[model samples]
Target: MVQLSLPLKWVALAVYFGTMSTSVLAFPQYQSLAGLSERELKEALPKLTPRLPTPPPRPEVYQGAKLVDDAAHPWRAPRAGDQRGPCPGLNTLANHGYLPRDGVASPAQIIAASMAGFNMDLQGASIATYVGHLLDGNLVTDLVSIGGKTPKTGPDPPGNGLVSGIRTHGTFEGDASITRGDDYFGDNFNFNQQLFDQLKDYMNRYGNGYYNLTVAREIRYQRIKQSIATNPTFELVGHRHFTAFGEAVFSTNMWVDGRVKGPLENHVTQEAAEAFFKNMRYPRGFFRASKPGSATNDQLQFVLGTDSSRPGHFPGKNVNGTNSFTIDHSQGSVADFCAFYTYFVGTRIKNLYPNPTGVLRRNLIINIEYFYGSRPPGIECTKVYPYGQL
Candidate 1:
């Protein structure tokens, strides 16, 4: 082996050092890994509005109004003479008697120690659906009599036992319309008498006995009678009333409102129900329509329609993934409820929440026929005059 001298070894080491330095200098520039660009956000967000704090989720109990329970709603079959006594929904509260049977309430126990229950449901439904329920459930069935086996007939033939054919449209021009009658059963006062009787029944069942029940009943009847005389028939068909007991199905399609060629006020005519269903093609899948000015995820929906062929239609998709059609109580009209509640409580809510200038003040009413039908079991408008087919 040839021995390398110390001087050569030193030179070789220097050469090695130079190669390492040169290799390091040839490395690529220090670039960062890909990242979100500042411009990306600027281009993405269109505009920023001051986010208003969402109103606290509806309270469990506002005054005496009860919050609607999703689970309990479908089970709330109306308990008229068929079932008799207080409804299961009300029975839940009555079992304890609106307040605790055992202990003190009010200052010490303001909140219900038990489940907060109202004689009528207050918060669960949309203003429209509730109104529909009120008209179909309360006014036509409970309020009116139309006594005798001589079935209430129109120009059209009466078909099946299923609830069908609502007189949603048409003016209250003649004696035939519910507007003219005072009682639902019997020829006497027509719907008017039935209305009084039902009011009496509500007082007996739900009233706290704050005032003379009979006198109060007379006062309430007068208000309804006057309302029918003054306003359009639709006004009598209060929106909240329909939603309360009527078979309602709502869709989440935000565009549904915008699709209207005319203003929304005009759009909610008698034909509106038919028009809305006609347009949607009866969507079956889970769809979401946001309430106006809500966040993207704040989607809403309702059942498409009810099968009046039976008292309870099979629950279906409500634009949301949840089953849509659900009803346990006979729909009660907000107008009637308002009248009833006010008579009991001794004042109206509108008196408390008055509207200011330019803004319209709304007195809640039921769009009864809109939900199911204004007619009896055999001849409901829902049966003959359906949304799309009609």
Candidate 2:
């Protein structure tokens, strides 16, 4: 277990597993949905936690390769009302109707689509969806725009509150993206051809015509270096440190056709990369990954390996001058898995809904639990309930 700076108190217990074995000291067991609440706090909260949406079933038979962009699922440009964002995977799914063409989807819909379209494992997709939805989405309606903020995600809160959708920078979307530019340099949602070209350059030199973990590590650092030199507000602290690398690894892992397996497991080719990054189209007869996959800790290690140059926990923002970074790992660091969790739930989520109550509060806690269970590489930390149990 992670030795959090503070001791684990009695407000809430770690609730990741399905069943609890034995408890020690004041700590208690939080099992399933039924155990989350004493009584339905509101009609919205059937239990203290909402039931997670079941992912779409994988086909029983693997017929050569199942075409995700098949006749039934045709690629179409997003209409004016439909949303698109930094996540090209979601955008491609929407283009082919794997998800709703409108781009506004519930956590359940998102989990289902990610599974069916990209074969992203339910755990991986849940980790992404809950964090994205809770922070940038509408908790009341359980809807989030895959692109820029839209009124479709229900009414807004008073004051500085923002239901800004997935495009809201500093939440899940952050700097050093594989295909998108930093939000500090303006429009971060749409594909930036310049940034993508840089990715191709690194891929040519590193992967020799393919996008893999090696290329991802180099390109990720290069992109960050670009941001630090160009954008004065470049910051890679907190969850952004994780995303900085995770996003690139995700592209390499998920973008390549799962049909091309064995020796070429995680290799994404040029023709295929262009289809996803530049055009948001699946290559001809594109098939979902042979199985569910995501940027797990093992995959992410490629980015945070023993390379002395790579910033592990020493992620920081440019102080003032170009390339003048002031390293700070105060909140957390990518090198420490539990430290990442401490920063994510304790800092980010806590700050977002400090005074949440009723349905709003209940959902936040449940979603936080989902994030806790996402389990990055060496996550052994106890869940932090920033807002103590009411």
Candidate 3:
């Protein structure tokens, strides 16, 4: 759907010499604040921050477990032409008609649908949606295929890789996925029964039948070990390092019956988990979280942590051969968003965009701020501006 492309409003300032880079940049109507005049950006110092995209208004109170996939939003199996992906969360959204069932969606549609359908927090939804859009979406069309590369997403942006959907390895999706295989194994999006079995096993052993923080960490640690032992190209660096934990938290929390408890309560039964992960359907009468929620920096630390003595605790790569990983202490961990942001924009984005100007450059500036500003409270990370100011 070409829904979010609003016409850019051009304005002239006599004092400013340079023309406003003829960048025909576009964002959702709610995000008009992010696309500022360079002069305005310069004038407004630390205050010129991107506002979180707010979803449609809702009832004040928590409406416990109702039919989320009701008559209005029914679940349907994906047809042959439909796209599905590594993230079961988005897949479920599409399956339930919260997103376009065809699998192509704009960042705004994704953000709104995700929040309205699941009560996802603005920060959490914005970060995930824009990351997918910026890295894997077609900026010209403002479309992202939730699954594999498809012409339905429209042509690739001039030189920014293939614009090959979220399933592209190491972009937004990466290794140690609880229910999916690494791209090295050939199919990264398809559900991996073997890995799911391991996940269930961890819940049985650690969480006593619930997927809590303890089960989350144990399963996460075990999965990394499995990948290191088996896969030839096992790399957990950059965004994957933190996103790995965020995904774990999503699984551990997303499908739970909200009537039971709180914002980030960890009590997802295997049945609820199985329903979402495998069937792409909610457990009947499912209610979303009492409040919008997701993992915080402290929560992420607890979920990603393991015994320091373990073999695969630190990030590394196999320079010599399989299993011959050299510890990459320089890559840093989820605890440090500053380093992650710096590395992500400075190195990662720069590779995709060797020299971005015009609309692309301005969009990059907006997206990264969405990422860092959402960092959990008490996480003292100074923002990194790789694209220079506005």
Candidates in order, TM-scores: namely 0.18, 0.79, 0.77
**Per-residue lDDT tens digits of candidate 2, residues 45-70?**
43223334333234334323467878
Write one digit per residue (lDDT tens) for candidate 1, span 172-251: 11112211232222232122444334434533443332112232333333433343343332122222232212211121
lDDT of each: 0.24, 0.69, 0.67
Question: Best candidate, TM-score-wise?
Answer: 2
lDDT against true structure, model 2: 0.69
Q: Write the per-residue lDDT of candidate 3 for residues 1-390, one digit (tens) a residue.
A: 444333322222422223222222212221112223454333322322333333323432553334466788888999997888888889999999999998877677887777767777767777787667666765434467787543322221112223267887777888878899888888888888888888888889988888888888888888888888788788877567767878888765457776776543668898888988778877887887666766766667787675676644666655665677666756565655667766766776666655555555666666666656555565666656678886
On lDDT, the leading prediction is: 2
Q: What's the CA error at residue 342 for candidate 3, in Å?
A: 0.9
lDDT, residue 69, model 1: 28
What TM-score does model 1 achieve against the real structure?
0.18
Ordered by lDDT, highest first, the candidates read 2, 3, 1
lDDT value, residue 156 of candidate 1 = 15
